[model samples]
Target: MPDSIAPDALRRLVLPDRVHRSLYTDPAIFDLEMTRIFGRCWLFLAHESQIRAPGDFVRARLGREDVIVVRARDGRIRALVNRCTHRGAQVCQAERGNTAGFACPYHAWTFGLDGALNSVPHRQSLPPDFDLKDPRLALAAVPRVESYRGFVFGSLAPGGESLVEHLGPIAAVIDNVVDRAPDGEIEQAGGVARQEYRGNWKLHHENANDTLHPGFVHESSVSAARGDPRDYAAPAYDGHQTHTQMLSNGFGVREWQSLSLTGFPAGHSYMGGFYRGGVLSPDRDDPVWREYRARLVARHGEEKTARVLGEDRFNNLLYPNVSINAQYQQIRVVTPLAVDRTRVTAFCFRLKGAPEALFHRAVRFLTNLSSPASMILSDDIEIFERVQGGLANSEPEWLDQSRGLGADRTEAGGRTVSAGLSELPHRAQYAAWLRYMTAAA
Candidate 1:
């Protein structure tokens, strides 16, 4: 592939079981992805709970666009471009806060929370024909915004699939998260943990559900946990969640093969949970989990609670930019800074009526998996950079994704399932990538 990729050339870049290396290294391809993939798809923005009150807002990224996700006084959530319409300066600088309106720093042109032009610095200086109500003078708003079980998403395109249609069956994973709460609600409790890596953003999603790499890429952390008896000595130990989680990644070949991985047509996928007997395990009977279960039972009854707690999916990827582990109340959002740079922001949720200890466990899970100093994520980040560095070479122009290509079995719901170690998720993502990259813009 050349530096300048045409729409027709994109199909040849992504094959049945291999993808061209230029997809990761080409600046032109990355620019096209920003407009076609991220711009058209419904990218995850802010959780509804994050901005529950009127005037509350948080700065977010919509592909290459900086946006402010705000709740207006009329109880509506709106995403507005952060740039000032007057002088092209950023209108909001804060990460998150509550305010009545935003005033541009370069000039005093102010806008309402809904991105409506409210006032100008010097109204008399403007021509009499200039109207304040002109839509072009206000901040640019994302064309479409929707929420599914409180997880907000925005699309830059004016028309496309609705959020529900786009999510397909993956919405059930989100439902499991919210349904686990006794009050049927979850809120963003802890502050976000962000880490920047020197690699393409696609690498994160590619590695998210790859069960085979954990035993190799994260061997140091997994071996350390395996060598420590404290990780597995006690069944009810609550403090060793991180160590136990590390140990879970050290599963043998047979154990990994026994697990199941499923891929969707829309680029979403998830793997069956591998943690069997740790505090992070769904079937664990620790006191904190017992209390949490009892609370859920009180609200949802025995059968419903069992169904909620029975879900065992992990690393649910929502296409281009989001990975959710609803079982642990964790969400990681990936943002592409450049062709070779990416940022991941992670947030943990608190079950509205569950015990505080459960929320603490969720926080610990988030830290162990996504924090800058995380044992697992640091290793993955190092490998991502190394992959990026290696791809700088011109040889080996194609990356193989045929690990388990011929063995995928389609289930009743149109999802393809395979052995856990298969690279089906990568292929699924590329299928969607090709569709978006080749579509008419």
Candidate 2:
């Protein structure tokens, strides 16, 4: 914990319907979050597909810690701190590649693919009492590393909930995507889209499931796509218009009734926005959709295939870092760079045994929507930057997140749910954040 923001002080940063600005801009708070939240949480590291063969490795970041996820010769996946034990210099410099082991360029210390100490320069120069069996000679490994359906995650904390328990209801959401594969296997395909935004990381977290902003924030883009020119200079909605009982209608006037947001424990939540087009319809005449449906039916049977393909969840916020968009076959990994900067990498996946056209469609969907040149993502990033700037002022000490505050209902398994556009997701996230942020380390 940072001495600047003690545990007791952290409690004051959050309230029932608001959060202190310092939580977004304070360096101390960010450091505490890296330790208390990211350090302990099961953070997404690497997909099994990224390290499919022995000696393959990919660099990963869990908050402030740098880790290397490697496939060892023993056919086991291992995650180790990137630092070399000899001089605390990073052993691996490449972002990712297949290598027999990592050699620290600084001191020529070598570690095996599994992070075991392999050799050191000038062995004869060592003291007589020195022993290679010393654990300190090996690279430090993360305390916990586990995978759920090929998605690997690492935790710095020794133990608590298993990976499956941390995922909670989102586990079903993940299964819904992986099961879409005809062979029940999914692989990272095509390529990755990396982007950086000058905004607080929490902004993206809140914006992921924030339904209230789409119709307004993306209004210009939507109008452009429709070949209609909507006034962009119109004043924002007045408080009266928003507070009207008829307009509220319990969920605060949402445009998509089919859209639903559900909050689960451990700060996990999902936004269900089934594919708007006829993409998932088995009866669609499109050759790609027809072929994909047939392959799924052959593997999972007609009834089961329907249920699997029909699930079109938009964004599943796994909390802290990763967001999965099953509808588009995309997984976005969020990495915080600073209190005011964040980096996001979007990966597209292909369902094994699916047709080439299906993979092409998946790639096109993510490229058009999540790529750095994407208009949708551009709008989101712009808003995030603006929000960060706006919050720097001292006038508004509290940001209101009270939408649908009293309208949520408790569901089975302790999930809190509300209708479309409700702020239940935000409330649920902050509740978990406070619990994790202030809890004993």
Candidate 3:
């Protein structure tokens, strides 16, 4: 297919610190990522809360396949192919909804919640070899579906590592995402905002862990956050309006100097605590924060809550699909539709029963600043497009990520660098990328 990675393309990607430009720009390499990286990894499916009731479902793109994840009547979540078994038409066309069973509009074929082919409109006419009881007739399930905490994940390949094994040391970070909530239960709140940006999926994924860019790129939103919104009262978008946002994005570089990286066996690496939390959403005076802290202390005790809250990281870039930002209400799921086009979904959550103001605060931070409409997000989008455009130059082919070389301290499972300023995270990411790209070799 178009995403296939050729040997020559593989040779272009210099090992360790640099990736060949073609890896980002080439359709072949992007396909390899889909197969080698996305296909094998335990891709984020959906939060358990979204499908709390049986039959609730959400449609998502897994590499090239369109799959629907639904809670079955048995209370088990199932990820089934959206394609109809008969004539190949897509089944369950709605983005998401509660359905006792999915009925194919074409030919009246129907499938049960478990993806079993329950009925075929003209079944008696079929040949003896075409058995309705055959598993092949069922909506093909994603090979493996697993959930860690309240987060759900599905994999296309059956041979790879188990979900926990793939997560490695980083699973702790994933668990932290939901466990910090009061009573260890976090709710999906606010709403989900999706936008299509003119950039490759990698740029958005990398920037999620980018503690360095917020200061410069997100200045306007920061200004809005710092500024009294009542004063501007919906000001028009101007290039300079992003001054505050850029400054906030700038805070990443300055504040994230303490990140400790730990590379794992899989292409997954955990880049620890780049941001000193309680700043954007302080736990000291904020009632929501106070309540969250009190509950956590009561449950897990002060020491554990301190550990959970103190090193609040900006995010954990879990290899291919998921970007689980530890602090705040941000969870971005990337769906790469083609070699060039990408869909980024941003979801903001409330802290269970925490204050609504906190939820509103997250909405403003995401919609006004990080959303596609935000001036800050646009700047990053501009860079990704320009970078993709330039990669087609066909001369001088590598993108340099060797910022702080020789400093990635070797730990038990992986390597790490304490200084957040170090491009240790970037190095860790590329290291993981190369391993997956060259795994078969």
Per model, how many backbone clashes are there?
A: 0, 0, 29
Q: Say which candidate scores most in lDDT.
A: 1
Question: Which regions of candidate 2 fall more than 4 Å away from where they truly are?
Answer: 1-4, 228-254, 276-284
| lDDT scores of the candidates, listed in order | 0.89, 0.80, 0.71
TM-score of each: 0.96, 0.91, 0.88
Q: If ranked by TM-score, best first, what sequence of candidates would result?
A: 1, 2, 3
lDDT of 3 by residue, 111-213 (tens): 9999999988776798867877799899999989998888889988877678888887677766776666665777676667787766678777666555566
Candidate 1 at residue 142, lDDT? Answer: 94
lDDT of 2 at 82: 94
- Give the candidates in order of lDDT, highest first: 1, 2, 3
Candidate that would win on TM-score: 1
Question: Per-residue lDDT of 275-353 in model 2, one digit per residue for the tens?
Answer: 5333232234567778888999999999998888777566789998999877557889999989999999998888998
Clashing pairs in 2: none
C-alpha lDDT (0 to 100) for residue 109 of candidate 1: 89
Off by over 4 Å in 1: 1-4, 228-238, 276-279
- What is the overall TM-score of model 3 with all chains considered together? 0.88
